[model samples]
Target: MATQPLIRSDHLFDTVELSKWELEQIMERAAFWEKNWRPGQAPFAGRFAANLFFEPSTRTRFSFEIAEKKLGLHVLNVNMEESSTTKGESLCDTVKTLSALGVEVVTVRHREPEAIQELLTEDTGCKIINAGAGKMAHPTQALLDLYTMKKHFGSLSGLKVAMIGDIKHSRVVRSNCWALGKFGVQVIFSGPESMRDHELEKIASYLPFEEAIREADVVMMLRVQLERHHEQLFVSAGEYFKNYGLSIERFQTMKPDAIIMHPGPVNRNVEISDELVEHPRSKIFAQKTNGVFIRMAVLERALGGVQR
Candidate 1:
C-alpha cells in the first residue's frame, strides 16, 4: 500500500469522518510498519515534536517515545512540574516557546480537553494531537483499541461492545464511542447512573450491568478513577463494584467467544475482578501491545512528510 497524505482530524467535523476503509488502511499500514520496522528510516528525521504531558502516563507517553524514535524524530519530553508552567508561565507561553523552536507537532495530555483546542486556535504553528485531555477525549487510546479489535475480530461492523464503568470520567469511553460508532459497532454503556452521559445518547445505548454483559462480544472496562472520585459520584468502591464490576459470574454471562478489555492500570477487584482480568478471554495485554503499533502509525502519518 502506498503511503497517503497525513490528514489531521482537527480539519474534520470529528475523527469519525475517516471512512471504515480509510481506518482499515491505516491499521494495515500500522501492522506492516510494526512487522518490518527499520530503526533509521527517519520519516521525521529532520523534524522535532514536543510531548507535553500535564497528566502522568506510562503507556501513552512511552508509546509516543517509541513511535518518535522509530520514525527518527527528535523528541523533547517536557515535564510539566519541572517546567516554568509551575512558575506561572501560561500554557500559551509554553506552547509559543516550543513552536518557536520549530517543533512540527505538539502531542499533549492535559486534564482539560479545551487545552488542545486552545493551542490550535491560538495560532501556534505546531500541529496538535490530543494524547488525552480531560474526560473529553483520548483519541490515541481509541485508535489503539480499535486496531486491536480489528486484528482480533477481523472487522468491527456487527460487534456488540459493552463499555463498563466510569463513562463520565473516562476519556477512553468518549473516544471509543466515536471510533467504534464509526465502524457501526453497537456500543452499550454500563455504569452507575451518575457516570452515564446523556451526550452519548446519540451514539450508544445505555444498559444495566448484567443485561449489557449477556451476549456481548467485547466487554471494555474503564478504570474507576479514585483521584477523580467524589462523595456524590458513589457511596463507595464496594457499591460501585457490586453494581457494575465484572465478576467471575458476570464473565460467564458473556458469549463464549467474547473478550474482555481494560485500559490499564486496572483496579483489580474493583472495576473488574482479578479472576476475570486474567481469564483466557482477556485482551488487556493485547490492547497494551497494540498501543505501540497504533502510535507508530499515528506518528508516521502525522509527521512522515519530512525527508531524512
Candidate 2:
C-alpha cells in the first residue's frame, strides 16, 4: 500500500485531526523553508492551485496566494461575488468545476464549517484547505500560530496561552485549543461570560481577565466580530475596553518576555490597546511573518512533500 501523507487527509479541516508528530514535521519544514529560501525553487512546477474565498480577508488570502506562487504553482483566484456562485451555482459545483479545469489544490474560506467538507467525496479530485470555516475551525491559522510560538520559545510543553475575547465565535480559538493540547500547553479562555463557550470550557479552564493575563506566557486577543454582530452581544466599546481590553496598565503587569498576539483586522482599542499592538513583546506582526513560511510548509506537505 502507498504511505499516507503526513496530514492523512485530502482536506485540512481542524487541528484535532493532526497528530503531534505531524505538527512537528510542519514546524520543522517551515523553519527549513524560512532559512533556505532561494531565488527560484518551484516545488509544484506543473501543478495548479486556486484560492476560492467567499469572505473578505486581508492576511489569510494574500498569504496563501504568496505561498502557492512561491512553490511555483499556477494560481487562480476567483472573486466570489463575480463568480458563477453569485448566479446560484452551488459550492460543490464550483469546486468540482475547478477540478475539471485541472486545478490540483483549492483553498477555501466560507462561513459554514461543514459546507466545504460536503465537497470531499470519492469523486472530487482536488485537495481542499479550510482557510476559515464559520465558528468551527481555521486550521491553518492555528498551524501558523503554533509555528510562531514554537519558533520563539523553542518548546510548547510548558507554555501557557490565554485566549481572550469572543471565544464562542472565534474559529482561531477552537483550533488553537486542539493544537495546544497535543503539546501539553495550558490553554485558558478569558472573556465576558457571553463570549465564553461552555463546550470549550470542558477542554480548557476559564479564568478571570486579570488572572488570565497574569499567568500567561502568550496573551492572544481576539477581535470582536462586528460582522457577526447580534443584538446585545456588546455594549459601548469604551465600556468593554475598560473591563476586558489589554490596556497599557494590564500590559505592564505581564512578564517582560511574554508576547501578545491577535489574529488580524484588529478592532484597535476594543480587545487590545492601540499602543501595545506594536510593543516590543507583541508577536502580532511576527505571527503574520511566520504565516507565510508555515503556509508554504503546509502547501508542500499537502502536495506530497517527503516527510522529514
Candidate 3:
C-alpha cells in the first residue's frame, strides 16, 4: 500500500509575504470549499488546534472556532482571563505546552505588534496562524475581503477601491494594502487627515473624500477606531458623519454598479448611515459570510498538509 506524503508546517502571518500564485490557490480553494463543504466534513479529524486570543474579538474568533469544528479538529478555546497567564505563565510557555500535548495548530490574536513574530521563530510542532497582531497584521481578514470582492466582481484586476475612514492604527488596512496591491486594484486612501498614516502613503494615492467615492468601483468604509482616532480637533460623531461618512447624499452620487463594503461592528450612522448598512449595494454582510468560508480555506491550508 502507498503511504501518505509528509506535510511541512506553514504560517499565515501577513499577506505581504504571499505571492500572487499562492493567493490564487487560496482564493480558488476557498470558493471550492464554499460550494462543496457539507456538515461534518472533517479532513483534519482527530488532530488538535487551539485558539489563543489574548485580545477580545467576535467575528474573527467565532469564525475560527466554526472553521476548526468543521475541519474535525479537537478545538481548545483558551480564555486568557482564566488561563495560566493570570498565574504568571508566559504565552510561549503555554503554546509550547500545547504543542507538547499534541496541538497541531494554534490561532492567536494578540495586542503586541511583535508577539506573533516571536512564535513564528519557535520550532513548535504546530502551525502558527496570526488571527490579528496589534496594528501589524490581520491576514485572514484581508483574505476574506479579497474573496468577497472577487466573488462579486469576478476579478480584482483594474478595480478601484476607496478605503475610507480611519487608516492609521488599522491592522486591516495594512493587510488589505498588501493583498489588494497584488491584483492590480487601484486602492485610494481618503478620510479625516488626522486618520491618515504617512507610512502607507506611497502605495495608495490620497484623494479628496468625495472624489474617491464617486470614481471608485468598490467603496470600502473602514470602522472609525474611536480609541485611536486622535484628531487635533475633536470631530464629533455627527460632524464626522456629515463631512466624511457615507451619507444618503453621497450614496446617491455613487455609481450604480459600485458596492459598499465595511469590516464591521459598524458605528451604524457614524461610518455609514443606518439605511445603507443593509442597502442593496452593501457587501458588508457578504464579507462576513465570506469570512467563514475563507477561514475554512485558511484553516484547512494550515492543518490540511500544505508545504511551507
Candidate 4:
C-alpha cells in the first residue's frame, strides 16, 4: 500500500477510510491505556457521549458504556424500544435530540450502514463512531482484534490470518480485511461457497478451509449470521460443521503457536468446537476484554483526548 495522508475525519465509520498510521495510533494507545489505565483518570472529562444502538449487541454496546463511564464522561444509553423511533420518529430526529442534549460524541450501531452517515452534517457539532453498521463495516471490532493480535505477537507484519465462515454477511470480516491489510498481514477467506462475497474476491484469495487453517498464524471464526440470510447457505448445520467447522482434531494440525479467535456469541460445535472456546490458544474472551480499553482510546481520541 502507498503512504496515505493523515485522516481528517473525527468520525470512524469504515476501516478502509482510515490511513494505516491512524489505525496504528489507536492500537498503540489502547495497549498503553490497558497497561496504565487508572480509575478517575477522566481523559474525556466534561464531555458527554451517547450510545445509540438500534441493533442487539452484547460486547460492543456494554464495552462502550463502560469505557465512557471509566473515562468520567457523561453517558446516555438509548434503548431503541423506548425511543421515539417506536412512534415513527426518524433517525435524524433522534440524533437531533441528542445534539440538543449537548452530546459531544455519538456511537451508533444501526442495521443500515448508510443511516449513520446520512446523519452527518457540516455542523453536527459531535463526533460519530461506528459500532456496527449492517454488513458493511464494524471498525471498532476490527481495531480491537488487531490490538489483540498485536498484544500477542508484538507486531502484525508477516502474519497470516484465515477468516472462516459466513464471510458474506460478516461486518467483522469486512472491516478486518481493510485494517489487517494495512498492517501487511496476509488475509484469506474460507466458508461455504454460497457464503462467499464476490466483492471480497476482487481483493482477497480463497483457499480450502483446512488448507487455509494449516497455513495461518491466526484462525478467526465468524458467526453464521443466519438472521440476515433467507436461504440456506449450506445443506445442514451438521454437514456445515463436518465440512467447514473448526474441530479439536483439525486444530491439532495447526502451528503450535498459532491461535484461535472468534468474535463472540459463538455457535459452539458449528463454526468452532465447544472446548476450544476455553482452549489455551483461544483469544475470544481476551478480545472482549480488550474491547473496553480500545473503546476508551477511541472515545478519548474522538473527544480530543484529555486536553479538551
Candidate 5:
C-alpha cells in the first residue's frame, strides 16, 4: 500500500502483480478519462492493435475494442476459427506474425491458462494483455469491478465482498481476491460446496449462502459457467435459485447499504432475481459501463509502455 515502485508492467496478466498504489492509479486514470476523454481524441492514432480471443467473449472483447478505437488505435479482431491456428499454426507464431506485421498490442483470451504467460516468454515486441484465461485470470474485469465498487462506495478498504457463484470455474474470482488482498477488504465465497476451491482458502473464507449475503457490503454474483464444468454437479436452475441464488426473500435481508453485482451474462432467476438486476442497489450495469473506462486505462498502459 506504500508508494508504487518506480517501474511499469507492460503485460497485465495478473492483479497480484499490482500494488494498491498502482490499482488506485489505474482507477484514477479511468475516472478522469470517463469525464474528460472527448470525441476525436486519439492518443495512439496511427498505431495498430488486435484482440485475439481464442475463447468466446462478448463484454470483455467489445469493451477492449471500444477502448482501442477511443485511443485512436487501428484495430483488428482475429477470428479464431478461421485463423491458421486451426491449421496447426501455434498461438505464439500467430502473435509474432501480428507483431511483425505492425500490431503494437495484442490482447488475448485463450483457453490455455498460460497462453499469455507463454507469449511473454517469447519476447514479442508488441505489448500483451490478458482478456481472460481458462479458470485463471481476468485482470481488467477485476479492476472494473473495483472501480464500480469504489464509484458507489468511494473506497475499497474494509468492504466485505461476498463473491457468490461459480468460484471453481471463475477467472474473475482470482483477480478480485488478489487485487482486494492489497486493500483491507474482507472477501468470502458462497456457492454450492462443489463450486468451492481449496487454493484460496487462506485468503478467503467459505460461508453458507445465507451468512454471506447477510454480512456482505457487496454481493458479487458470477455467471454459472456451465460450459466449463466437467463434473456432474447437476443442480437445476430452480434448485440453484432456491438455495444458492439470490432470491427476493434473501435480498430483503441484506444490509440496506449493501450493493449487488454480477460479472455478467447474469443468469437471471438463477444466480440472481430478475427484479434485482436493475434494482437501485445493483451495480451490474454500472460494471459494464465502467468496463469501457477501465479498459481505456489498461490499453493506454499497455501501449504507453508505462502508467503515467
Candidate 6:
C-alpha cells in the first residue's frame, strides 16, 4: 500500500495543526535558507505569484517580494487602488483575471479574511496565502514571531508571553494567540477593556494594565491603529495608553530575561514608550530581520521546496 501525502491547508488558520517536529523542521529550514541564499535557485523558477494587497503594508509586501525572488519566481504586484477594482470591478472578476493570467499563488492582504476564503473556494487550483486580513490573521507574522522567540529562548513551551494593547483590532494578536498557544506558551491578552476581544477566551487569559506585564518572559506590544478609533473601538489614544500601553514605568515590571516585541510601525509614546523600544530587551528589530527568513520558509513550503 502507498502512503498518502500530508494535506496541508492553503490557509494557515492556526499553528496547532503543525506538529512540534514539523515546526522545528520549518524553523531549521528557514535558518538554513537565511544563512545560505543562492542566486538563481528559484524553486519557483518559471512560476508567477500575484501580490494582491488591498491594504497598506511595508514589511510583508517587501518580504514576500524578496522571498519570491530568492526562490526564482516572477512576482506581479497588483496595486489594488490603481486596478479596475477601484473602477467597480468585483473581487471575483479581479481574482478571475489574475488566475487567468497563470499566476501560481495569490498572496493577499485585505480588510476581510473571508474575502481570501471566498477566492480560494472560487479558484480551485491556485494557492492562496493570507498576508493579513482585518483583525483576522497574519500567519507569516506569527511564523516570524515564533521563529524570533525560538531563536532567543530555544523553545516556546511554557514561556510567559504578554500581548499588550489593541487586541480588538489586531490581526497580529489573533494569529499570535493561536500560534503561541500551540507551543504551550501561557499567553496573556492585555489591553483596555474596550479593545479586548470577548471571543478570545479559549486561547488566552485576558488582563488589564500593569498586571499583564508582571513577570512575563515576553511582552509583545501592538500598535494602536488610529483607524480603530474612528470605528469607536477606543475611547481616546491617551486613555488607551494609560490603560495598557507599555510606559517606561510599566516596562520595569517585566522579568529580567523578558524581551519586548512590537510589529512595526510603532506608535511610540502611545503603544510603547520610546525608551523601551530602544532598550536591550527589545527584540522588535530582530523580529523584523526574522521576517525574511520565515517568509522564505513559507514560500519554499508553498512552492514545493528549493529546486536545483
Candidate 3 accuracy as TM-score:
0.94
Name the top lDDT candidate: 5
lDDT of 2 by residue, 1-308 (tens): 12333444356778898899888877877787788778698867888999999888999999999988888889999999999998999888888899999997889899987787786653567888888998889988999999889888989999999999999889999999999999999999999888889999999999999999999999999988767757677788998999999999999898778999998778889999999999889989999989988888788777777333
In candidate 2, the residue pairs with backbone N, CA or C atoms under 3 Å apart (3 or more residues apart, or in different chains) clash, namely none
lDDT of 2 at 154: 88
72-135: candidate 6 lDDT, tens digit per residue? 7899999888999989988767877877888767788888778776876775356777898787
lDDT tens string, model 3, 209-231?
99999999999898887655444
- Weakest ten-residue segment in model 5 by summed lDDT: 1-10
Residues 1-308, candidate 5, lDDT per residue (tens digit)? 22222235488888998889788878877887798789998877788999999888899999999999988889999999999999999899999899999998999998887778899888787889999988899999999999999999988889999999889899899999999888889999989888888787778999988999999999999889998988767559998888788888999999999999999888899999999999999999999999999888888777663333
What local lDDT score does residue 226 receive in model 5, on the 0 to 100 scale? 90
Better of 4 and 5 by TM-score: 5
Can you give the TM-score per candidate against the true fold? 0.90, 0.95, 0.94, 0.94, 0.95, 0.89
Model 2 misplacement above 4 A: 1-9, 306-308
List clashing residue pairs in candidate 6: 42-71, 42-72
Using TM-score as the yardstick, the better of models 2 and 3 is 2
C-alpha positional error of residue 105 in candidate 2 after TM-score superposition, expressed in Å: 0.4
Models sorted by lDDT, best on top: 5, 4, 2, 3, 1, 6
Best by TM-score: 5
* Candidate 1 lDDT, 1-308, residue by residue in tens: 44553444232112454676656656776787777777667666777888999988998999888887887779999989899999998888898899898887778988887767687678777767778878777877888899888878998899999988888788788778778877889889888887777888567888888998995799998898766766578777788788788988888888889999998889888899988777878999888878887776776566543353
lDDT of 4: 0.87
Flag regions of model 5 displaced more than 4 Å.
Answer: 1-9, 305-308
Could you tell which candidate, 2 or 6, scores higher by TM-score?
2
Q: Model 6, stretches more than 4 Å misplaced?
A: 1-22, 230-236
- Candidate 3 deviant stretches above 4 angstroms: 1-8, 229-233, 306-308
